[model samples]
Target: MTSTLALDGIKAKQQKTWASGDYGAVAALIHPMAELLVQSADLSYGARVLDVAAGTGNASLAAARCGCDVLATDYVPALLDRATDRAMAERLPLSIQEADAEALPFGDGEFDAVLSVVGVMFAPHQEVAAAELARVCRPGGTVALANWAPDGFIGGLFKTIGRHVPPPPGISPPPLWGSPDRLRELLGGSFELTITPRDFVFRFASAAGLADFFKEHYGPTLKAFEALGDNGKALYDDIVALADSSNVATDGTLKVPSRYVEVVGIRR
Candidate 1:
C-alpha cells in the first residue's frame, strides 16, 4: 500500500476505536499532563485557542474551562461528535470542527494560542503539520505540543507491538515528537520552543484488566488486529500472550508506566 493509503487505514481503525467511547474512560490517563500544559500556557481569558487533533477534547475542554473560546478539531468525525457532546454537557464554549492537522481549515493568524496534547505526532506529515500550526497562530502567540517519550513505558509498548506486526507497505509509523532535540528540530524556527519531561503511572486492578484496557484503548494496535487475516490472527494471539506474560505485578495493581515530552513554542 502507498503511504497515504496506509495512513488512511490506521486512521480508519482509530475512528472506530474512539467512536466506541472507550477512549473517554482513559481521559484520566493524560489528565495530569494536560493540566500542566494549560497551567504552563498562562492563557488570557478571551484567548482564541485551537486544539488540533483534539481527541475527545481533553485539552480543548481544559482550555475552555480556562475561559478561552476554544475550537477543537480532529480528522475523525466520531471523535469530534463526542467532543461536541462533551462541550454541551459541560457548558463549555467550545466548537468542534473536522480538520486535518496538516491543513487546518482556519485562516492565517486566527488563533491566540494552539495546543495539542499527545496529538500532533500522529500527523502523517509532521513538517506540514508543524508549519500549519505556526501558520495559524498570531505572532507572539503560543503553540504547545505534547507527545510521548520514545524510551518511556508507552514507547516500549509500541516497540514491542511493532516487533511482532510488520507495518503495511509504504506506511511509516507516526513521527515521535518525544526527545527535546527532536521536538526542537520538528517545531523550531517557526516558534521559540521549550521542552519539559512529564511522567505518569497507570495502575490496573490486575494483569487481565491491563490487557483488556490495552485491547480497548490502544487504537493503532487494536486496529492492526482487526486488519489481520487468518494468519495474522495467529500472530496477534502470540503477541497478546507475550504482552500478558510480561504484565506481572506483585500486588493486584498492574503498574503500567508512561512519560511525555511537552514542547511549548511561542510564535516568532
Candidate 2:
C-alpha cells in the first residue's frame, strides 16, 4: 500500500522537485550524513573522484580538502552553480558539471572512485544508475553510496505525514537500504559490497528553528501540498503543528533522528 502511494508521488514530482533547484537548502540537513559517507569512501589525496547527484558539493568539497581531484555532477544546474561557487570560495580544485546519474557523461573507467551521498536513491532508475557508477569506475576502484534507512525516526515521521497527505501519483516510499541484503541487491554483482549503518540526530535550538527548517528545506513537501488545492494549506498547518509539539527542549533544541546506509563497493 505504501509502495503504491510512494511510486505515484515519485512519478508526479520526479521532474519538477527531485530534479531541480528545489532541493538545495535541504543539503545542509544531510551534511552530517554526507560527511560519514565520504569518510567511509577512504579517499586519499590525488584520488580521481566523481560525485553523482552532488548537490552543493558537500562530499566533493570534503574529498577535495583531502587533496582528491573531484568532479561533482548534478542534474540541476542551480545546484551545480552553487557547488561551483562554494568550491571557488574554498579555493578547491573541484569541477562541477550538469549530468544525470543513470546516464553519466564520461568515458568508461574514468574515475578511481565514485561516491553518491543521499542521492542515488532518488534516481528515477536506480539500477541504471548503479550500472553507470560501475561503468565509470576502474576495476579495483571504489563506489560508495548512501541512502536513508527505513523504519528510523525520519522514516516514521515521513510515514506519518504521508498518511495525512495523499502521496503524489506513481511514487512509493523508498526502500530502506540499511540492510546488507538490500545493499547487495542494489550493487552486489557489480562490486564487492560492505554496508555501514550510521545515525544522525538533528538538534534544533527551538520550535522556530524547526519551522525555519521546514520553510527552507521542505521544498518538495511544500510544493506537493500547494498542488493539492485547499486541503494542502490545512495539511501544511497540521504538519507544522506536529513539528511544534515534537520540540524536545525549552532552550530551543529539538533532536530529530535519522539513519543511513553506507555501502562501499569495490569494482570487480
The candidate maximizing lDDT is 1
lDDT of 1 by residue, 25-124 (tens): 6765766777789888888899999999888888998898899999999887877787888889998888888988878999999999999988777776
**Residue-by-residue lDDT tens digits, candidate 2, 1-268:** 3363564455446545654334666776677666777788888789999999887888888888879999999877778888888889989898888887878999999999998887766665556677899999999999988777775655654565677665554443554445567678767888998887776666777545665566446655655555676766555666556556654555656766566678888999
* Model 1: per-residue Cα lDDT at residue 224: 50
User: How many residue pairs clash in all the candidates, one count each?
Assistant: 0, 16
lDDT for residue 31 in candidate 2, whole number 0-100? 75
* Model 1 lDDT-worst window of ten: 235-244
The regions of model 2 sitting more than 4 angstroms off are 1-12, 18-22, 164-172, 206-208, 237-252
Runs in model 1 deviating more than 4 A are 1-21, 169-172, 228-252
Which 10 successive residues of model 2 have the least lDDT summed?
168-177
Tell me the TM-score of each prediction against the true structure: 0.86, 0.83
Q: How far is candidate 1 from the true structure (C-alpha RMSD, Å)?
A: 3.1
